[model samples]
Target: MKKPEVTEQPGGDPPSRRGRPPEPIGEDVGVAHRTWLEPVRDRLVASGLTLDELVCRSGYSKTRLSELLRGKGYYPGWEITYSVVKALDLPPWPLRRLWTAAAREADKNQGWIENRIRAVQPLGPELPPVAHLGLTQIMRGPYTAYARAFLQSENRAQRAVGETFDILWLTWDEAVAVPDTPRHAWQLLRARVMSRAAQQDGHPDLRQAAFATVAQAGIADLAERKTRIDTMADFFDAIARLPQDQMDVIVLRHLCGVRAEAVPGIVGLTPAMTHTLDHHARGALTGLYLRTGTTVTIDTLE
Candidate 1:
């Protein structure tokens, strides 16, 4: 067969001299695509597939794949990304999100003139744009984990995660417009999950579930175990009574496994403020446990 370059020549008019740079939009477009695809491609190649081998399996010409992996102006579409994902024998989960983000950046770069024109329109409030990426799937597990930690019920946690996704759907466009869309979605999900968990503090069903957890974990045979269970119940109740900020910091930092230093980024506070909240939250928990004559350490909470 002839060289693949002949089969996949980039379709566009000749490069016009915009008098700004040789390839004004090329770098941005290339970087967006390369950011995710390059790593995957390198991994596959290291596993033994050559460029020509990948081209044959994926049905994408070598020239096109090479340019895309190099972060050229032409970002791959979903079809191409899907084909590559299959060829690389990788899951479509994150690759699709990366491709969608890259495609959005590429489209924005190519349509700068149109965007500028749209910017001047006296349009009413803009609706959020729809995200084609698998952002929901990406966030589902983390959101569920967060809810489970905060709410302490698997069923409630799943429902809370679903609700978070529903809210994300409504604000999809706004979330996806940011440079780090996943991080934005995470912050939104965290806030929603925590809010829903907080609302459950007075819920009769949650109270019952807490008792159920204690009963399920503690048996009646041992007096010592029963006393520990009682203390555990008081611990959780005390946690529920804490303020929202303290509760959130405690849950995210300890339960969700978020780093202490990184908690501020998710909670939108300075490092010092995050530390202060953590200190206050621990003190509150300590005070609550002390009233019951049980010495509970912050280390035990973690």
Candidate 2:
């Protein structure tokens, strides 16, 4: 394909810049797309390379490169994507994982995905040893439980945790540089979970989970079962109203069954702070139960 002709300025700079500054990636874009697209855009901007230059290096036409960069039209295959990734000097494996996910989200078939990926040569380097170890630790930790409490699906919670680790791996350097690495990592995990969490009055809606509690009660009568469900829903709503730290404490300690000792590490709080938050959250829930005259026995809160 003939590349778009670039007119040279006095200093031999290409006149055509990265076409129209790439359309602003809005919330309408899927998370998978945003995950990879944002980094690619950042790398392009940081590299200070023009669209004409990218076309020359990627060996693709400017129009195709422009559309791919803007995330317009259909999803581009891995061949073109890897070409651009190489041209920008960005890490390949993470982008490959992210791109494959976005492609799947776009409804591309497995056969097509395999074919497209096979067209590109695989890169040699892998996630650093320390980052891999950190990923393993967080995976085995209470993150999935915390995620499951909000997401409510084993598959979704697992995906959220996996994606969080991928993001952490990508930003491992900056994460380690922070004063509190666990806290930084927790924030990333929280963002990923909350983005997909069901919302009620701007908080994560946990009412749906109340059914499980009601089910465990084994109340057969329809009227009693409904009352139990409603009461549990109210309790969950109250839990949702707690301050962020307290709410996290309640969810991790009570809903997720994470042990008191482990709560501090998972939520990135000191032992004292975790205990205080748990205490305050229980007190607040107890007060709500008392005021409403709900006769629910919460063993965990006790």
Candidate 3:
């Protein structure tokens, strides 16, 4: 199929003028997340800094930035997005204009991402250690990488199960199952200390219960046996909205059954502070669900 051509205007026609629709501005860019690059490239070109000069301020390698601008290779992250925009020192409106252009270009080429993914032939499932992947791993970025691989291997229903359980449960189980460095020991010790503190605090039980709620929620979220149509989307959407730090609060306290007092030691917060954060998060979610009135049909965990 012939690619659609877009007309490029220095601020005039778009770059291509094929069957594709004109890309939307920044706010309208869909959730694919790397839409910032198109704008980043435009800013670098407009600033007259030359690639070398832009790299000096942005700290990105001039070569890599150039490759991205020329569409030689794709990037998995948008460090460049914020960097180029920041380096330009452009007025906010100017930066916004560039951002809009980039988003349009990115949306136009979105399929290239899928083609790249399908071409990967990594030795089967050499799934990385969860620690290396980090918090956002489950929701976006690397986590999205995991989900794509997972979907390729299994049906949506099974992938959903793995998303809830294998993706998370297995990681935690595996982490605790084997031994690792002093750092890992320290993390475990921290959790124990916090758990003890929660016991000392009268709210220990509440902390434990709150933790359970989050774990169950995550599990339900992952396995997604939810029979209701679109419940999976809502479940995943809700999880996506949760920050890693807050998700940690859920996993540490609920799934692990650690009391509130013990949470701070493992997670770097005070007992009072942890409690506040947890309550606020739950309250916010409840409000979100109520406002959206998104009902999830749940399947009981086996």
Candidate 4:
């Protein structure tokens, strides 16, 4: 099927967007890629194009595109970015000179670019650029994907803004995995099974390496206070895998620390059922603690 051509009405977006337009924001070409090109990439994302469609027209494979989004491979000559941006039916002339100069400067110091990416990633998960990617799979995602600018490293400042958003969400994912929740039962079922994600060996955060080692040892953390945190994480690996009903109860009881009286509003479980559920969860956690030797800060709970 052929795609129809759509035309832009007048001088672009009518009323000027308040604050500053994202162009000419920086002087040095290298810095401009991070500062200046941001708005350009953002303009593309605001447009409506699917990831797959964007890649096809842009000529860069999905994998390469992903790296660029992560701020890893933004060094390719202007032609590549040009092809991708132009396919959206927008002009790329003036922007070309800016980014072109940025690319040449980028070539001189590739290592510094990746280090900047590392600086913005949060403490826990760091999804690196995919390795061992084939050409076919690489071309599947959008290059100038107007949508991915949401996920892309558009620029350092923009990425810093995004990392903040992830921090809040991660806090919640952590809160929900507590074992006193009916969700804990689901976790006990898989304690030893899910402890194999050792990819954090190269992780920049010490906690990551520490946790990965804990999981591999079937022990979560050795430090007493940190012990509860890690054990909670271990239990969550399994709880997170449970059915929705059970996970909901887990969150109600443990994460939010809601009492049995409030369980009905959240999970629709009767008061009697919630009480029984909490009792069994307590017993399960106590028994697991004794058996697994997962330690917590001494005298803190005493």
Which candidate number has the best lDDT?
2
Compute each candidate's TM-score over C-alphas: 0.43, 0.82, 0.26, 0.26
Residue-level lDDT of model 4, residues 1-302, one tens digit each, is 12332445566854432222222322443553653355444544545455556688888886765555435533644455566556654334334434444554567455543443344323233332132123113311221121122122245323333222222122222324453322232232122112222222331111232343344455434675366456555654433333434544554455434555656533435677766665655555556556877653211121
lDDT of 4: 0.41
lDDT of each: 0.57, 0.79, 0.42, 0.41
Query: Which scores higher on lDDT, 3 or 4?
Result: 3
Ten contiguous residues with the weakest lDDT in model 1: 16-25
Error of 3 at 154 (Å): 18
Better of 2 and 4 by lDDT: 2
Q: Residue 62 deviation, candidate 3, in Å?
A: 26
Candidate 2 lDDT: 0.79
Worst 10 residues of 3 by lDDT: 141-150
Which residue pairs collide in model 1, if any? 30-71, 129-173
Please give the ranking of all candidate structures by lDDT, highest first, separated by commas: 2, 1, 3, 4
Q: Which model, 2 or 4, shows the larger TM-score?
A: 2
Candidate 2's residue-wise lDDT over 125-194, tens digit each?
6855476576557645588888887888999998888777776665565578799888888888889898
> By TM-score, who's the top model here?
2
